[model samples]
Target: MNDLEHVKPAAAPKKPARRRFLLSGAGLAGALLVGWGVTPPRQRLMAQAPLPVQDGAVALNGWVAIAPDNTVSVVVPRAEMGQGVSTALPMLVAEELDVPLASVRILQAPIDKIYANVAVMRENLPFHPDDTGNTRAVTQWALAKVARELGINLTGGSSSVKDLWLPMREAGATARGLLIAAASSTWQVPPGQVRTQDGHLFHDASGRKASYGSFAAAAAQATPVEVPLKAPHAFRLIGHAAPRRDSRIKVDGSARFGIDARPEGMVYAALRMSPTIGGTIAGVSPVPVLAMPGVLSVIDFSGALEGQTGAQAGVAVVAHTFWQARQAAAALSIRWDEGPHAALSTATLFEQMAAALDGDDEHVYHSRGDIAAAHEGAKVIRAEYRAPLLAHAAMEPVNCTAQVSGGKVRLWLSTQVPTIAVDIAAKVAGVAVADVELHEHLIGGGFGRRLEVDMVAQAVAIALQCQGRPVQVIWSREDDIMHDVYRPAALARLEGTLDGTGTIRSWSSRGASGALGHQFVRRNLGLPAAGPDKTTVEGGYDMQYAIAHQRIAHSAIDSAVPLGNWRSVGHSQNAFFKESFVDELAHAAGKDPVALRRDMLAGHPRQLAVLDAAVRRAGSAPPGRAHGVALHQSYGSIVAQVAEVSVEGGEIRVHRVVCAIDCGIAVNPNLVAQQMESSVIFGLSAALAGEITVTGGKIDQGNFGDYPVLRMPQAPRVETVISLSSEPPEGVGEPGVPPVAPAVANAVFKLTGQRLRSLPLRLS
Candidate 1:
C-alpha cells in the first residue's frame, strides 16, 4: 500500500483566511476603528518571545546575545541573498556595542511580529515620493502599525539596513548599558566612570577591566536602560569596509543553500507540475513508478492545500536518491487538464494590454498642470515601449526539506518570508502555527523569488506521505524557469512636449501591466491588495525631473500570467520606458541627452550631483564607444549611470559603466559597491537578452541555454562612486538596477542612432 493512502492532509483553516481577508481589506476603516488616540505604538525594539539560546549563550534582548566565551551574536531577521545583509546589519550593532567586527557572530532571528519588516511595507505604499503631506504621513503610520499586526517577515525591497538601523543600534546600546550596570555593580564603581572599548569594560581609577563575556550573566539580570547612540563622527565599524562575515564560508563551500539540505533518513522527491499555468493533474498511473528500483511511491499532490493563489497542483515521485526520483517522475504518465490558460500566449496578453490601453480604464496616479494645455502648439513626441516577461532564475532551484509527523512539521529552506513559510507549512500539515519548526539557510539567489511560500506548502504536502521521514523535494531547472511567478509584461505609452527653449513642458505617461502587488498579496497574504499600487507607476510618476505639467496613469490589466516582484519591481521596466522617452525628447530638441537631463534636475540637488559625478568620471566615450546616461531613484536611493557602448556586427557590447549613487550613508561601502556591480550585470542581461515567451500556454525557455544571464566575458567594468552624507542609509540592492537598462538603451541609440523601444533591444 502507498504511504500516501494512510496519511491524511489537513484542510486549511477558514477562520484565519477570513481574518486575513478582513485585515487586508479594512485598510483605513480598521485604522479609524482603532482611533489614533487609542492606537498603540509599534514596539520594534522589544522581543515578543525569548531568543533561542545555545552553547552557553545568554539572550540579551531580541537582537543581541552573548556567550560565556566572549562571543557576541546579533540576530538579524532579514535573509542573506548575497546583498550582504548578514554583514552590513551586524555593523550597526557592532558599532554601538564597541565590539571588533570579527568577534561578533550572526544569528537568524525567529519568526515574530517584532521582526516584521516595517520599512519595506511603508516604502511600498502608493504615496508618491514628493507627497510629504499629513495624509501620506497618517496613512504610512497607520499601515506601519497594521504591518506589525499582520507580521509578514520579509527580506526583499532592499529594506534590511533601513528597517533595522535604529532597532539594532538601540539593541546594541541597550546591551552595552546592561553590561556597564553589571560591571558597575560587581566592581563597586560608578557606572558613569566605567568606559567600554573593543568589547571590554575598563575603569582607569582602580585599574580594573573585564570582557563583555565576564559580565554576561550579571548583565542578563540588570534592567536595560536606554543609552544614547554614538554620533556619526564617533562611529568605528559603520561606514568602514568591514569584511563580509559569510565570505569564508561561501568561498570554502561550507555555506548551505536550500538545495544543499540533507536530513538523515531523508527521501528524495521530484515534482512534475502542470505544463500550462493553473493546470491540474487529471489522472496518474502510480504502478509504473512503484515497480522501478528505488522508487518508493507516487503521490498525487493536486489540491493538497486549497486556496493557495500561486500553488501548482502536481504529482511527486519519491525515491532513495534525487536522480532516481527525477527519472521516475519523468517516466510516470499523467493526463493534464490544461484549464482555461491552455489557449493563452504572450501575444494574447500583449493584445489584452493593448486593448486596456486603448480603453479609458486608466487610473491616474499623479496629475499636475494641464498636459492638454501645455501640449497645444508644442513640439509633441510620442512613443510606446514594451518589456517582456522575466524569470528570477535564482542559482539554486526552489527546494525544501520537510518532515511532517506527530502533528508537527520541520522545514529547512532559504526563504525571504519566514512567517508566511511557517503558516503555509502548518496549514499543509494540519498543525498549529506553533508546531512548525523552520531552519533558514543562506539563499543562493533571491531577487524576490523566495518571497512566495508556495514551494514550502508543496514540500510539506509531499513530506506528509513519507511515513514520518523527511522528504527533500526539488524542482528541476526547467520547472523553476517555467513555473516562476514572472515579472509581468509591461506596455507604456509616453507623450511629452518640448517648449520653444527645448525644455520639457508637459509629460504624460500611460502604462498597462498585471497588478503585481495584487497577485503578491493574494499568493503571500491570502488576500487582495487594499488600494492603488505605487509599484505600477513608480518610475513614471516618482521621478525628480522637475517637470511642471505631468500626468502618470496605469491601467492594471488582469491577466492569467502569474506576476510577482522582480528586482526593482515596476522600476525595473519603467525606467527603460521613461528614460528612453526622455532621450527621444532630447534628440528631437537637438540637445545632448545628458545635458537635457541636467536641465530638469534643478530641484533635486542630490540627483544633480550624482549625475554630474557620473558624467565627470565617465568622461567622453573613447573613439567608437558612445556614452548613454540615465538617472533613476527607487527605494529612497538615487542612482545615475553612464554606459559606454560599441556595436560590432549588430551586437551591443558594453565596455564600461560609471555609476554614482546618493544612498545617504553607506553602512558598508564594499557591499554597496558589490550590489551596484551585481545590479548592473542583472539589469544588462535582461536588456541585452532576457525574455520569457509563452506558446500554447507553456513557457518556451527551459534553462540558461535559452534564458541566459550575462557571462563574465560579457560583463562590463563597473566603477561605483558613493556620495558622502550623514543622512540615513537607503537601499542600494535594487536602486542600482533601474538605471542600467535605460543607460544601455540610450547609449545604443547614441552609437547606432536606432531608438529601440522594446526590451531585449534588437537593431534592424
Candidate 2:
C-alpha cells in the first residue's frame, strides 16, 4: 500500500470528481474569513504561544531578547530578501540601545498578528499618493487602528525603515533606561549621571562602569521608561557606512535559504501543475512513477489557491532526492480541466483591452477640468503605449519545507507575509492556525513573488501525506516562470496638447487592462472589490507636472490570468506610459526634453532637485549620445533618471545612466546605492529584454535561457546621487524602478527618431 493512502487531505467539498481530494478546502477558507472579523490584530500577534528559547537567554519584549553571554538579540519581524533590511532595521534598535551595532544579533520572529504588514494594505487603498486631506487622514487612521488590532505585520512597499523607525528606537531606549535604573539602585548613583556607550554604563565621579550583561536580570524586572530619541545631528552609526550584518554569513556560505532547509528525516517532492492558467487537476495515473528507484509515493497536492481558483490541484512525486522526485514527476501522466482559459493567449487579451477602450464602463480615477474642451481648443497629440506581462523571477525559485505530524504542522520558508503563510498552511493541512509553526529564513531574492503564500500552502499539503516525514516542495526554474503570478499586461491611450509656446496645456489618458488589485482582493482576501483600485492608475495620475487640465481613467477588464505585485507594481508600467508620452509632447513642440520638464516642475523643489542632479551627472546630452530624462515617485520617494544611449548595428545600446533620489533620509547610503543599482538592472531588463508570451493556453518561455535577465557585461554604468534630508526615511527599494524603462525608451526615440510605445524596444 502507498504511504499517501494513510493521509487525509484538506476538505474541498463539492469539487469536481477529480478534485474531490481537496474536500473542505473552501470551507476552511470560509472559516478564515469568519475568524478575521472577530480576531483583533494585537491579540493575533501578542496572544500566540511563545517559541522555545535557549536556557540562559531571556525575552525582554516582543522585539528583543538578551543572552547571558553579553550578546543582545534583536527580534526582527521583517523578512530580509537581499534589500539590506537586516542591517538597516537593526540599526534603529542598536542606535537607541547605545550599543555597538556588531554586538546585536538577529532572530527571525514567529507568526503573530503584530507582524501583519499594515502599510501594504494601506497604500493599496484608492487614494492619491499625495493626499493629506481629511479623507486621506481619516482613512489612514482608521486603517492603522484596524491593522493594529489585527496585527498586520508585513515586509513590502519598502516600509521597513519607516514603520519600525520610531518603535525600535523606543524599544531600545526603554531597555537602556531599565538597565540604567538597575545600575542606579545597585551603585547608589543618580540615573541622570549614568551614561551608556559601547554596551556599557559609565559613572564619571565614582569612576565605575558595568557591562549591560551584568545588569540584564535586574533590568528585565525594572520598569521601562520612554526616553527621548537622538536628534539627527547626534547620530553615530546612522547615515554612516555601517557594515552589513549578514555579510559574513552570506560570504562564508553559512547563510540558509528556503531551499537550504533540511529537517531530519526529510523527503523531497517535485510538483507538476496544470499547464493552463487557473486550471484544475482532472485525473492522475501514477503507475509510471509508483515503482521508480527511491520513489516513496505519488500523491495529490490539494492545489495552490493564490489567484483565480486560489487552490490549484496537482500531483506530487516524493522520493529520497529532489532530482529523483523531479525525474519521476516527468514520467507520470496526468489530465487537466483547462477551464475557460483553455484558449487564452496574450494576443487575445490585447484584443479584449482594445474593445474595453471603446466600452462605456470606464473608472475615472482623477479629473480637474474638462479634457474634451481642453483638447478641442488646442493642438492635440495622441499615442498608444503598451507593456507586456512580467514575472518577478527572483534569483531563487520558490521552495518550502514542511511537516505535518501529531495534528500540527511546521513550515520553513522565505516568505514576505508570515501571518498569511501560517493561515494558508493550516488551512491546507486541515489543522488549526495556532498549530502551525513558521521558521523564516533569509530570502535569496523576493522582488514580490515571495509575498504570496501559495507555495507554502502546497508544501504543507504534500507533507501531510508523508507519514510524519518532512517534505520540501520545490518549483524548478520552469515551474516558477510558467506559473508565476505575473505583472498585468497594460494598454494606455494618451492624449495631450502643447500650447503655441511649447508648454503642455492639457493631458488625458485612458488605460485598459486587468486590475492587479482587483484580482488580488477578490481572489486572496475573498472580498468584493469596490470603487477604484488605486494601483491601476497610481503612476499615471499621481505625477507632479503642472498641467492646467488633466484626466486619468482606466477601463476595467476583468481577467482570469494570474496577476501579482511586480517590483514597483503599477508604477513600473504607468511611468513608462506617462513619461514616454511627455517625451512625445516635447518632440511635437520641438523643445528639449530636459528643459521642457524643468519648466513643468519649477514649483516642486524636490522633483526639480533630482531632475537637475541627474541632468548635471549626464552632462547636457553631449554629441555622440542621446539622453532621455524621466521623473516619478513611489512609496513616498522621488527618483529622476537620465539614460544615455547610442544606436549600434541596429540595436539600442544604453552606455550609462545617471540617477538621483530624495527619499526623505538615506538610512544607509550604501544600501540605498545598492538598491538603486539593482533597480536599474531590473527596469532595464524589462525595457530592453523582458517579455513573457503565452501561446496554446500556456507559457512559451521556461527559464533564464529563453527569458534572459540583464547580464553583468550588458549592465550600464549607474551613478546614484542621494540627497540629504532631516525628515523620516522613505522607501528606496522600489523608487528607482519606475524611471529606468521610460528613460531608456526616451533615449531610444532620440537616437533613431522612431517613437517606441511598447516594451522590449526593438529597432525594426
Candidate 3:
C-alpha cells in the first residue's frame, strides 16, 4: 500500500443521492450563521483540531488550501518581498495538480504548524572538532515531527519552493485521487472508470458527469489515495512562463502589503529611541510632545532593556495618524543609556576582527592533504580581502500591526518567520502560541531582514499596554537603517601554492568575522560560544573545486555590532574573496580565469557546466569590455557569472552579465530567470554601492539617499542560461546573489589592471 492508504476517510458519510439536494436548501439557513461561525472570537476559541478540508479540496501542508472551484490558494509563508516566490512556488503545485494556472490564488499564510521549512535544522550542527557526532539525525527527526504538528514555517535560506516541492505535489495529487475515487463510488463504477479534467469529473459509459463542486461533499468523505506525480516530460506549466500572479496587483497598487494593512480602530505608533543600537531609555520627558495635535499617548517602552532576545527599547508616540505619530516622536526628548555597545565603531570592529585572525586560536572547519609541504615546495601567492558591514534595505520600512484583546492577540506583519513572530507575540502578551493569530502580509522586501520578528514583538508590547486597543507600529527609514541587524564585516587571507605545471598544489584560507551562530547559541541553546563561524570560513572551506591539498580555518571575533544573514549569507562576501583570489592566481599563473577554474574543477561536472556556459556566453573579450568569471555553489545550486565591464575615467561601468545556473529542474523557467535578474541587481548594488557604516555605535547611513540601491537606468543587461536537468530544484533566490559581486570586481581588475580586493569597488 502507498502512503495514501494510511489516511482513513471521515467517519460520517454523505447520504448518497439526497445529500446534495438537502444541502442546497440548508445553504439558505447556514448563510446567516456563516459570519457568526467564522468570526474571530469563534475561530480563536474553537478547539485546536485538525483543519477541516472542504469537500473536493485538499490541504497540502497548511499553507496550501485547494477548493472544489479548482482554485488553489497557495499559502505563502515567505514574504513576497519582491522575490517572485509567490508566482514560482504556486507553479510547482499547479503543475502536479494539472490545473489551469489562472485558477490559483495566492494567500499570505497564517501562523501554523505545517508551514515550517525543515532545512534550517542543519544550522544546529556542532562546530567543535570533538563534537563530531552531534545528534543531527535525531534532531532532524524531532524537528520534522514538530514541524508537521505545529506548521512553524520559515522563509530564509532560499529553501522555500525547493523544500516543499515533493510534499506539496503529493498533496495535490492525493486530492485529485480522492475526487476520482468519490466520483467512481457515486456512479457505482471502478475508480479507473472515472476521469477528471480541469474542474469536472466524468463517467464515460454512463454519459453522466458533474463539476468538482457538485461532488465536493462526497469527495471529502472518501479515503485519500497516494497518487503518483507526473514526470517532468509530462509537465505543461512547471517549466513554462506564466505572467507573475502578483504583477497586475502590484502594478495597479492593489497588492495589500504590510504597510497597506489598516485594521479597524487602529492607532499609529512612531518610535523615538537612542541612536546607539541596544541602547535603552534612561528617562523620558513627555512634556515636549503632550500638547502636540493628534498625539494620543506617550508610552515608555522599557521592554527593550529586559534582556529579551532581539528586543529594541524606545518611546512610542501613539497618535491618530502615521504623520501625527512621526511629529510627536520627533518632538519628544529622552535620556539614553548607550549600553555595552557605546564604544563600538565600524573601524574599531574591523580592527578587532583583523586582530583575531593574527592569533593562534582558530577552528579548522575543513582540511585535507599536506598544506605545509605543498606551500613549501611551490610558488605561493597570497591576498587579503575585506567586505564592510551591509544592511537589508528593503523598499518597505519595517511595520507591524497588533490587536490584543481579552487575552487573545492578532498580528499583521510582513515577516519571513511567522512562527517566530507568533511565539514572540505570545511571550510578550503572556498568552499561549495558539492564542496568537498572525496574518502575514506581502513584504516590500525581505533580503533576510524579515527573518527576525523584532518589529512584531514591539507591536505586541505596545498593543498589550494600550488596554486591548489595536496598535500599528511603523519604523521610519531612519529606524530601519540605525537599528538594522547588519551583515557583518569580514576579513579573509588566502594563500595558494602553484606548481610548475600551473596547477594549484595547496590552498589555505583563514578568515575572521563576527559569529552568526552566536545569537542562536546564546538565546536558544544557551551555549557560551558559537564555535567556528561557518559564515567566515564557508566559501573557501566548502569549495566545490577538486583541490588536492586545502585547509580552511576561521577565527571567530566577537563584536557588539548586531549581525545577521544578508542575501547570500557568507557566500556573498566569500564569493568575492575566493573567486577574486582565484582570478588573481590565474593571472599569476598566466592562464585564463575561465580555463583555470575549469582545470581546478575537473571532478565537479555541475560546477564545470555552469562555468563553461558563462565563459562561452562571455566569449574571449579583451581590454575595454574585459570578461571576468566566478562560480559558487550554495543552497544546493551551482551558479557561474561572467561580467563584462569597462573602466572609463577611473569609474567602473558594468555593461552586461551572463549567468549560468544549475538549480536542478527549473520549476518555472520564467520565475528562475526573474530571480536571477533580481539577484544580480541586488548583488550589484551591494558590490558597487552598498555599505552600512557606524560611528559611536550608530549607523551612519539612513534611507536610499545615502544607502543606495541599483536603479533601472544603471542596471546591467543580464542573461541567464539555466542548465536543463532532471535533478530536484535546489535553490534560486540567494544562489544567484553570490556570483555577481565577484564577477564584477574581477572584470574591474581586468579593465584597470588593479585588483579590487574589497567590496563597493572604489577606484583611486
Candidate 4:
C-alpha cells in the first residue's frame, strides 16, 4: 500500500492557539455573563449542553476575543454544515464592531450552555406560523427561558442566523462601546469626540488614532454598557455579499473533515452492521479472520445498547489500513439477530398508516371553525398525496476518530451538535460528559445527519477496545445509507369546499405519518412521547390562507422504519400535499393558481407579497411552456415559488424556477440566493429520483446507483428574488425546499392534465 501518511502533516494539532483573557487586561467583569446547567430536554427536543470551559484563554463572556494582530475573533457556537452560519454570524459581530470583514476571525467554541441554541427548541412548541395570540408569544418566551437555563446548544431548523441576529451584534457593540469609553479617558475627550473605523479608534479633534489592538487591554478593563445598534439603512457588511471565509480553503482541498483526521499512532477501523434497521449481532467468531492482512482486532457492540443515541450495533474490524480493515470485515462470520422489524415492509407501512387515519387515536394539530358545519352544504374537494421515505445521502459518509485513556476521551469529527456528541461519547466510553474533548471539524455535508452522535459513540467504543491507540472508524457509503434514520413516508387526505360563487368556504386536511417531534422526544430524551411534533404539521396547517371553517390535523402512525429530519422535515412532504391540493381547489373553482393564493393570503401582506413577486418575476413562460406556483411558511419565514415545466413524450422536464422569499432582514443576500438555488436542486432530486424503500426490514436500495441525486444536466435553471424587509432575519436554508416540489407537481398537472399525488411524479 502507498504511504498515505508520509506526505501528510502532523497529527491533529493539540489546542493550537487557545487563550483565555485575564480580567486584569480586559478589566471586563463578566461582560456577556450568562449561565445554564445542562438539563437535557425531556420529550421535547435535544441539544448538547455546556461543558466546563477549558483553562486556556482568559474568558470574556462566552464569545468575542482580540489578538495582537488586530483581528477581532468571535466564538461561534453553531456548526457550519455547508450553510453560511460561519460567515453570516461573524458579519453580525464585524458589522457592530466597525471592522472590515477581512480583519475578523471565527473560533468554533467549546460547548457551553451559554451558547445553547434556543430558537430551534422554541420552534418545537406547537405554535402555528400564523398564530398571533399570547399563547404563542408566551409559550415561545417560556420555552426559550428553559432552553437558556438548560444550555442546549443545537444548530438545526435553519435558526442559526435568527438566534444570533441580535445577541452577536450586541456583543460587538458592547465591546466597541467599552473601547470608546477607554479612549474617552485616555485622550481627555468626551465619548462623542471618538469614532471607530476599520478596527481603529480615532479622536479627530486631538489628532490621535490607535488600532483596536493597541487599546484592547484598556478596553477590556472598561465597564460594559448598552449602546445603540446600527439601523437597517446603515448596515454596510450585514446586507452586502462578503466572500465566504471557508471558501478558499474548501476549494483548495486544504479543509480538514472528520475523514482527514490522523492522530499519532492512529489506526483505521471499519464496521459492518446488521442490514436490518433494528437488527443486531448475536455473536461473532473473530478467529477465522484474524490472520488477514493488517487485521488488528474485532470488538462487538450491541446495536440497540445505546438507545435514543441511534448507535448501530455490530462488530468493528481494526487494521493498519482502512482498505485492509474493510477487506477483513467482509470475511468475518457472524450470527445475526434480525429483531422485531425483520418482517416490516413498505407496503405494510402504508397499510398501517392508512389504518391509522381510520383509527380513533388522532392528534389534532390545528382546528378553527367547524369543518362538519361548513362541509354540510358546500362543494367538497378531496384528494390524497403520498411521499416516500428519503435518505440524507451526504457527500461524506459518517466517520469519527477517537482516543480514550486514563478515564478521559477525545473525539474529532464533523458533527452538527458537539455538546451532544460529547455526552454520547462519554456515555459510550463509560465516563462522565465532562471528561470528553470534542474537536469538531469541517463537515462535508450535514442536512441533519450530523445531529445524531451515534457514529461518534460507536467510534469511541472501538477506540476503547484499541488500548489507547486512536482509531478512526469509517462507515462505507452503503452502510451509511442503509442504516440511516430516514425521513418518514407520509400519506395525507384532504377535503375542502367552496361556496356557490367559487369563494372558499372551508378546508380540512388530515395526514397519517410518524410525528417527528414525538419521535425525537421519545428517542433523544428517554421520556414518554408527548404531544404531536409541530415539525410534522408545520407546512400542513400553518398556512395563512383565509378560510372561515378550517381544520388541519394528523394521525400519528409509528412505523418500524427509523424516521428523522430531512432538509425540510414534515414540510418536505406536507408542502407537496398542501400546495398540490391548493391547486386542485383552484381548478375546482376555475381560478388561476397564482390568483387563488393571492386572494387567500390577503390578510398576510408578507405572504401575499412573495406570492405576487414570484408570479410576476416568472412572467409568461416562453412559447410551449406552462407554469405552476406554490406558497408556504416554515421556520418563521414565508416563501413562494413558480416552476416552469415542459412535458414531451411522457417525460416531464422542469425548465426554470422563479422564487421569492421574505426572511426578514437579508443578513447576506447572496447567501440567501445560493441557498434558494441549492434547495431547488435538493427538492427536485426528491421529486424526480429520490426514494428509500424498505422491504423485509431491509433497505432495498444501497448507494447512488439506485438512489440517484439530481445531476447538473437535470438541475433546473433557478432565479431568486429577495423581498426587502428590516424585521429580524428568519430561516433561509429549509424554506426554499418546501415550495419546489409542489411547484413542479402543480406545473406537471397543468401540462400533462394528470394530478400526480405520489412523489417521483411518473406519468403513463
RMSD of each: 2.3, 4.7, 12.2, 7.5
Candidate 2 shows a clash count of 28
Q: Give the alpha carbon lDDT tens digit for every residue of 1-764 in model 1.
A: 54345223333433333224223322633643365535675777768888887898888888899988889988889999999998999899999998988888888888777888888766655677878899888767776776777777889898989888888998999999999999888888888888999999999999999999989999999975457999999988889897888899999999999889888999998988999987876677677678899998787776675687467878888899999999999998878889889889999989999999999988888899999899888868899999999999999998899998898899999999888888878767778788889999999999999988878888888888888999998999999999999998999999999888888899999999998887888887776665676777788888878789999999998869898888999999999999999999999889988889888997878999999999999987899989999999999899999999999998999999999999988999999999999999999999999999999899999999999999999999999999998999999899999888889989998888899999988889
- On lDDT, the stronger of 1 and 4 is 1
Each model's lDDT comes to 0.86, 0.80, 0.74, 0.79
lDDT of model 3, residue 5: 27
- How far in Å is the alpha carbon of 589 misplaced in model 4? 1.1
Model 4's alpha-carbon lDDT is 0.79
Whole-model alpha-carbon lDDT for candidate 1:
0.86
Q: Given candidate 1, what's the lDDT at residue 554?
A: 91
Candidate with better TM-score, 3 vs 4: 4
The true-versus-predicted C-alpha distance at residue 712 of model 3, in Å, is: 2.2
RMSD of candidate 2 to true structure, Å: 4.7
Give a tens-digit lDDT track for model 2, residues 454-534.
788678767777988999999999999998888889999999998889999899999988877766655544456555767
Superior by lDDT: candidate 2 or candidate 4: 2
Q: For each candidate, how many residue pairs have backbone atoms clashing (under 3 Å)?
A: 0, 28, 7, 10
